[model samples]
Target: MHFSIPETEVRSDENGSTYVAYNIHVNGVLHCRVRYSQLLGLHEQILSDLYTFFVYEVRKVTKLFYFLPVVRQDPILGSSEMFNSFLRKAQQETQQIPTEEVQLEIYLFSGQKVKVNILTSDQTEDVLEAVASKLDLPDELVGYFSLFLVQERGDGGCTYVRKLQEFELPYVSITSLHSPNYRIVLRKSYWDTAYDSDVMDDRVGLNLLYAQTVSDIERGWILVNKEQHRQLKSLQEKGSKKEFIRLAQTLKYYGYIKFDPCITDFPEKGCHVIVGAGNNELNFHVKLPSDQMKEGSFKVTRMRCWRVTSSVPVANGTANPSSSSKCDVKLELAFEYLMSKDRLQWVTITSPQAIMMSICLQSMVDELMVKKSGGSIKKKKRLNGSFQRSDSQQAVKSPPLLVGAEVFTKLSSVSLRGLSSSNSASDISGNDFHGNYAFEGIGDDDL
Candidate 1:
């Protein structure tokens, strides 16, 4: 995420205690208010996660040189302590691949290799077709084979296989961590029964995919061992039968649990914000005891920037009774939000329970951004007859930051054509094709 620190304002509470409030802009929009301490905490968490991801990625590379006995015996290359230092050089070499062309090696089921030259913009389908044509495979049998990206892990094994989506294309630059030239295996698809079953099972990496999905909710990579999984199963079994069914269904369909702290609001009571991804967009709802409400949502891809801020409450006189100051320390979000209809507006979120909600949404958006940019960039054009407005009258960019009802006006102006309402608490977790990954109950919002 792109971020910048803006001017600071010193805010004082009723007791005259003051703190410096830092204004941060995310994606060129005022996103939120945060103090120094909160920034430090968030930074620490982010750094820890990055460190782990980097280490895991680097460990995968070390496996490539494992068989070179002479290289291991060399003092500079052999020492475990020097792995971190060599990781930098390895990454640099990977990134140095020529920009115009990429070399790909296809590993066949019979332990054969075929090298191909292709442009970075080439689609995955082209590779499959090329391979099939070379092998003289009939059209009927073509579907039996699938291409897989062989990614290594921190465990010193090439067990991670990322299945390429039909729509996916190779990255244009080798500098990207996901550059396609690293490794590609043109083996029989899961339908093929002739290959080594053990190697095929390892290539699927269903456990790793589930772990990654769970990390999205848990906000960190957690190695849930067999014992912990058993405990979770036991707890679900002892509780409501419906809960157990739901848990089993979630594991079967989505391959992850819905126990995110931000999703549940953990220890905090009262009404809280609910956020989820749907149809290339972010949807939010507020759940209360009496009623459920739609807080409105913005397109995940259009958010140009964001910032966070915090509220400092001062002690008030007992008789005056400012309980809000004592119980509700709000975390505000300021962001440049892009509406589905191409309208742009500045958004600020100040709900006390929704402070961490921004972080959760941010993570989902990062993934969406990657997928959206993976292929060709599609430029959407306005229809000729819709609303009948002239091209000159249309807005090329969103106006300056708008707050309050105006923000809602810009957001609601966009049509909600295929949007549907479902009971998230009761519905069984499934593939998120409809974009409702989280529960949506309605409640009133002070915003």
Candidate 2:
């Protein structure tokens, strides 16, 4: 029942050419030797086809064992007795374990770890509530915070992988990753920066914000000048958590989610840039080939629409064309940028982390809309397993800007084609563009 690919070995073919092969083992016994190219080829196949291929292979093995005697042969083909014993032991072990309750370790924004007990079937919402209860967070204010699956980097910085969805079981999702570096950290989730004032009123919330802000400064996520740093250190000594947060907010990229380096087709094509999302804008630090860096910002309000596109390099023939080799996926995040009152431009950025960029942008827009409506940020309501807007909220005049892959494909054929041709600002005015195309919300599925 235990399967592992122990190691890879270099081997020679009949033509005396060297290639690498993997030793696939099952329960300490070698089952098969697969070449690197073969594995790549298998991976290239579509998921449904690959599933069918595995099923067919299993059937063949089952039939071969069916006709064989019960006598033990090579260890590669495990004996029937041993197989049945493993199955029985597995069943017994499964039965002995209690699935009703499980212990989960959740981390706070300040790197504080706390353990809570919850049911195995508990969803993210239930787990969040349990964590909040442990922290004694007010019920009304619970919506201001969320649980995130974050990956801790070796250099002390951390990456926000994704926000845990309401429907997902946090325990199962974290366990399935099989990595210790990934942890569920509770952090403030509201878009409005001013909301931090409300959170600071509570002792626990104030400490959480202070810890996170200080961590961000030390981790170099927030930029602070020498004098500002000195002031922050003084505040830290005085235990001024509120003042520290207030000062930190004045620093560049404060409250922003930073993304890894990516390539953007802005100012010029294939410009390397570091992107950050926060304060209703996508901030960029473009690094030029001449070793110079230029700063820019894209406001969310001016973004007419945006979409994420992904393609496997192997399929696109951008990688090894003749050989079936596994290749990295290429992802592009394209947004309609308002150049002027009547002019729009399409800006595209290429990065493996494009989806995350899109999510952050959409989240920023959601928060902006909430702030514009003069209402408090509320948790998105889930109705029948989907998000539903409450009737109390005013309808947004502008259509949804965040789009998925399918809509991107359609837009590529129509809007892209139209936009490619040069037109005056008056020709494609804001009113004309908005009136012509209607968009829907990106929805929970994009997460």
Candidate 3:
């Protein structure tokens, strides 16, 4: 419930009208942004209520019956008709108020969904438990699964937007995006591939994993040859969920999260690349200008540090440009990679989803840290009794949201920054960069 307005920016709409946008962060993570007009109108509504309350108190104390014959005029309402209309439209879209209960359709990696009723005040953990209870997922195994906001692409692939934080309200987070392409998807959360066996031991978990693996194959996320594909098909036909998953795990990009084709400065500049993150590494398939493809991977253990930066375009001396004026604001992500004992290399990638990629990398590092520290796996307490498995059902489909394409059209340019040891070694060694554990226990041969 804690909130903070950490940053504010003056932004302009397509009509050239300027407005101050306040970025609202809840529990340290960016939640939503609101315009000045919207906040002003909301403030007016609160003031109106206070005015009514004070008037009633005064009338009671004074017993002002003598003023009853006088015509009383109500306070004038605020002139934010646009804000008022926005509130009304939001209510209509959600079909419920803050206090009312809403049904959230939580999707599994298998593309099946389970409907759970919750209030707007419910947190991510609450919804996860509700979905788990419906699926009859064991409490012990629950820790292995988490909810993610994934964008289903038009081509059947999915881009993971983020793992919903425990403090985040899933319904509000998803709805606030104002895009139908996003959904709350349940997926395995651990980074170590060794944990897959633990999940496969459970019937419900086995089926969920099986369904997701098959879906990945069908969507071409997992690469396989003719012989491997034929073998997998035979196991799948035999209803061998365990064997299927075990085999699929050996394939390329099995547990990796694949991103849409983006531009990266790896191997060559302006190379069209497809990136996947998993197993504590980033696998890249770059297509050169000559139509040749090159493959490369970057291990998290070799990274010294990484960051995501956003820059706005400014024209001449003006920080904000006119609506018709076009300027590029680059959204870039860069990471420092260890090449040798004393040598380092910086890799940069430009994409609208750079933020998500950064998050995935950080998550991988965190998972490894926990594993290396031998920390106990965090699990939620379970409810008594097991429930029946829900039938596999197709999720409600909608047109994919072209968020990246829209961003490119709105922004002027995009580029990433690189760091050299001679220029940034001190800064990297300081608190600014925390990935110093690159050489701790993992060696070059291990990577």
Candidate 4:
């Protein structure tokens, strides 16, 4: 069967043979090939070969992703023993690189990895001594100098630096340090950690979080007032112990600060902050029980933040017990509230808030996939005798390789993600059929 494609020019050879070569992008990936044959009559052979090459290119691209993030985050994996084992197993499974040849290829590719060379400067001994004394100097920070360090080859030749006795050259500027001279050519991402040319696929949510910041939120909120405190004091004065507790809870819920009840008999829930932590402030853990708790006790359950009147419904439609609302809600509410008001505890996000922005991107991708698969709500029309109820069933009837491409790409990408870093969870969650989030973290750490 023929696939629809743009018109292209083709010319016949002297022997009456014809050839045409061009590029087609599938799922944000590309492949290039030129073909020649006696007669190209919807040639099934070409389709098969094209699919083969398509899969290979996809594997290579995905391999870059799988290996890249791992190397970046986990230093253990970057060690020679582990890296060499990885090469051995990968070559065996894919046969893309022969096991015997993997070392040479990896070395050849070493040039692309961040490199640094520390050449012997005048009176290099002191510099070498200082560098040697510096703990955990990664070759990426000082690899180019690896050459300068060695008087002879031991095991990995010039590429391996673990055996070096000292930093090869002192006075060579470390490209990474604030201003230390150690001539380091490390991957910019290793130091930069913010942007990567390889990671733009994740551009969506980051754009929004960057656009919105703390200052924007502060403008919208009104702080807790004296009247509310006055009302609370009236309850306390009347000896309405329960009423005072309830109001205290209300104030806390609204983001007003609350000290733990000082009564010795009360079972602790959370330690009281000896010093009040600022709104959304990342409070440090004291060696002692929190001031919020009894002198030696901890809170059994954290008191809800007084500031959040609302929270977003979860993706699965479950409401957080801490939130007042039960309905599925937009996450933007929490963000907006935090930005607008003061006096509620600070939001403790481990990473940049830009991640939430990517959700809209995910939705957009899902929509595009639905469109690409042919609009919502399929009109029930049958052609010939080959109708099927699901794409999975339809896939059963397509050519084996064509149907398998989905699996091939997924199998290659998932294992890397599932096993990698703290980011493994995000990798799996963000990877959808449209390939929108595939390589985003490959280049940068949101952390």
Candidate 5:
């Protein structure tokens, strides 16, 4: 709920009118952009509203009213400092607001939805547990499920999907963004499916895939030689849905970049680079016909910056020489090592690889930043990179909230029942709950 008025930048429109654009960051995340005119209008609105509220009091023949200036005679309210001061006051007022219940629409992967009321200040874990109970998930099976906030963008637009991590911010605040189109989806088998399968089938032939020696298959790196490429193509031709799903479900934090160190300099040699993340470090290795070995890598904590550059197609040997407009964009990723700030280590990767690497690096950096800031790391306890399942029983005996039922009706029923029982203290606010039930566009909704 924090707000900040950061530095403004000069921007121009198509009509050539330039204005100062303010960057409004909320809790370190970019919320929205506002122009100088918007700030002026905001100040005017605040002044008008406040003046209207105090007009009658100011008109009294009281000593306090004598010192009050008329609206027309008041000091200017549309300055940068005035706008900032108003924002600061507003931020302080927002913190004083009491925590209230917020209704969240929980969407299931099977396209069904159930509504649940949760407090705004409730932690994400509490919301998840409530969701799990609503979904009829047993204690043992609940570990496989995870919640994701889905922002459904307009048709053909990009949809943003964010996994609700255990240590994430409160559930209510995250849903407030794009509220109309936002939904909390319950995804089953949400953990790393590939790793889970590998663990379960460790005694099988897949063991070769995770072998330690260079001659054997490496766990994280993908072998992209001609033989494997042919094998993948053959598997594709066979078109077995199970096999395809197995291949596609093999997840990697850092995507495999196939590159050959010896022939990587000569683009015509068809080299590739394979990369992986291990123990807070980025592992870059080269896969060759005869031998596979580590090329080079650096700990993510040691990186200060990541710079990317694009090159002309002609310079890259992979591009077709005859067609000038051919798809031949070669991307270069450069890392500024903290220990050696004077020089940067760079690598050539395709556009897709560059994007994947950037995403992985950014995620790692964000986590490292959190750790450096001394935020508690509440990672799920794991044995060999896998979570250990808990065997405790779930408290709920029956479905807490019935699906396809009106939320208010169910809540009212429970509150009334609890009032008659000995558990009256555990019920929601007796008469206040019904009065405070505020639903946005709830009339047309069936539940």
Candidate 6:
């Protein structure tokens, strides 16, 4: 059983009429044909839903299909198909690696210590093989981080640690999700990898081979605790005492859950915000200039949404019903968004909710921006106290800012064939592999 799908091309006409066409051959039979007009994003969702059906059908037969999707030609992979494909591929069984791509955030502490956060659409294997191949770090412990721990169809589906401590002092410690700040903080001094790659091109903080980071999401380092995690119990249906208590601790310890007012330094035109987790499935807030936000007068007030996830209705008190005054600026959130690389595109809503979502995403953004040369230069003179490094790695350079879709395009374009492919089960193990794999999903069609 094999699934071979032709690369699709979707484009809109001057009239804004979008057309999409693709062909799929399953088991050498042209079984499905997909055609749609406009709404490429929605079309990807429908295609992903189709994948679930196909996966079930394939499993019943031989379970040896490629589910081949031509690399590059499909915009659906990024605009919408990404999440859906990830869910389906995680359950796939075959020698071929699924098209799902994993995104990660690596935090570099001064000295030798480091922390990495892995974010992937597919939750299959858990080693930082692809990452390690790019970096010069020793392969002792490859950590995994997630809000939810998945039992590998085995191990009761509980989460565990995979760490490597071969390096000298100030080396990395692995912990998943929110490991309640358990490790000892030797000193407040810290050195961060540049948020923008161009910042220090000459300085390879961690000499990387496959360290092809698509983008830097933010700045500040993450806080994780290991001892508290080791003591917790695993309870409920697929539950872990260590992980949950750790999450609660992270929220309280950081006072991150506490409310903060919305503030920013940029114009409200190209600006937007998200609330909750970094995933795009969350809510959104769009800030308009006093002139564009015509829902009456634009007042400088936070707006809350009717729903926790969606901004369906606008809560009152954010703006005047007249188009006279404009809303004041909350530019701070925009700077914060540099941390998480804006993988998720939140939905739009009213006052406080808009403010809340903006508050969260911006923090991530700001963190990353500070790492870039341009960002670092702006703050170099002002940064003070323990959080600052001696002669920060901001001497490199900075690239121009691009839209979210463009960033994805750049990432997908990088050849993954550089990473070793999966090996036979005989050699199957954690964090070890030997093969060449080219990541195919979007951006580059020549592959």
Per-model TM-score, in order, reads: 0.27, 0.65, 0.67, 0.16, 0.33, 0.20
Q: What is the C-alpha local distance difference test score of candidate 1?
A: 0.36
Per-residue CA lDDT of model 6 for 1-447, tens digit only, reads: 112332344545569997653433322223333443222443354455546433343233221112222221122222123433332332231112334444443332222433333433222122233333344423321221111111122322211111111110111121222343323211101112222222222223222201211011011112334553333222213344233423433421221221212322222334332222221112222244453321111100111111111111122633221122222221112211111122111222333323233333323223333333234322122132111222433222122122244222212111000111121112212322111111111111211
Instruction: List the pairs of residues colliding in candidate 2.
Output: none
Global fold similarity of model 6 (TM-score): 0.20
Off by over 4 Å in 4: 1-66, 71-77, 81-447
Candidate models: Cα lDDT each: 0.36, 0.59, 0.60, 0.23, 0.38, 0.25
Candidate 4 vs candidate 6: the TM-score winner is 6
User: Total clashes, candidate 3?
Assistant: 3
Give per-residue CA lDDT, model 5, range 256-300, as digits (tens).
322222223211233454545443445554444445443555555
Candidate 2 is scored at a TM of 0.65
**Best TM-score among the predictions, by candidate number:** 3
TM-score of predicted structure 5: 0.33
Better of 3 and 4 by TM-score: 3
Task: Rank by TM-score, highest first.
Answer: 3, 2, 5, 1, 6, 4
lDDT of 5 at 131: 71
Estimate the lDDT of model 3: 0.60
Task: Give the Å shift of residue 202 in candidate 1.
Answer: 3.6
Mark the regions of model 3 whose C-alpha exceeds 4 Å error after superposition.
1-21, 25-30, 33-97, 317-329, 380-447
Q: Show where candidate 5 strays beyond 4 Å.
A: 1-98, 138-147, 161-171, 186-194, 198-247, 250-447
Over 4 Å off in model 1, which ranges? 1-204, 210-271, 277-280, 288-290, 293-297, 314-329, 336-369, 372-447
Tens digit per residue, CA lDDT, model 1, 54-162? 3333334232111112222222222222332232222223334343677656665334666667655454556666666665554444444567655544543342224
313-360: candidate 4 lDDT, tens digit per residue: 344644332222223211110111111112112222111111221122
- The local lDDT score (0 to 100) that residue 294 gets in candidate 5 is 30
What is the Å distance of residue 149 in model 2 from its true position?
Answer: 1.3
